[model samples]
Target: ELKVEQNPLFLSMQEGKNYTIYCNYSTTSDRLYWYRQDPGKSLESLFVLLSNGAVKQEGRLMASLDTKARLSTLHITAAVHDLSATYFCAVGGLTGGGNKLTFGTGTQLKVEL
Candidate 1:
């Protein structure tokens, strides 16, 4: 079984600062994904990186995947109070029938002004 790990499990940043969240996996994975969640709410898909060097960005969030390195990253640009949420990365578990998402520990970000 592959293990997914995320760094800086807890984050506190100013509203105008910038930061990056890191995600690493144990084994070979064909895909990488990022999601965001608010307290007691469902996850919102942020990015899905299916290939090496795949990158996606929206507003203050940006995600990228490097298959060869078995790593992914989520970057917050000019963090905002509204961006405070838990970010997660998921990888592997492709069983042909469907994808079983294995999520990371999750990074909790708090943007204080």
Candidate 2:
């Protein structure tokens, strides 16, 4: 079975700060995805890491994957109020029939001014 563990379940930071969220998986995975969700909204895809050492960045968020270590990281640079949301990392692995995704508990970020 594939299990994912994410650190810093809750993060409170000031605007213009930087932080990183980590995701560790128990088994090998084919793909990794990062998602963000607001208080009352559905999840929004942030980034997708296709291969080992793959990195993607948009705006203030950056995501990277290390398939060799079964790890993924989401980095936030110059965080702002609009970046406050719950972030999730999902890993896709080959199961019995098809690939399945297992999500982490999530890291809640609160950016303050």
Taking all chains together, each candidate's TM-score versus the true structure is 0.96, 0.94
- Candidate 1 residue pairs that clash: none
Report the backbone clash tally of model 1: 0
Write down the worst ten-residue block by lDDT for model 1: 92-101
Poorest stretch of ten by lDDT in candidate 2: 92-101
**Which candidate comes out best when scored by lDDT?**
2
Give the alpha-carbon lDDT of every model.
0.91, 0.93
Question: How high is the lDDT of residue 97 in model 2?
Answer: 100
Q: Write the per-residue lDDT of candidate 2 for residues 3-111, one digit (tens) a residue.
A: 9999999999999999999999998775999999999999999998889999999999999999999999999999999999999999987779976788999999999
Runs in model 1 lying further than 4 Å from the true structure = none
**Per-residue lDDT of 3-111 in model 1, one digit per residue for the tens?**
9999989999998898999999999886988989999999998888899999999998899888888989899999999999999999967787998899999999999
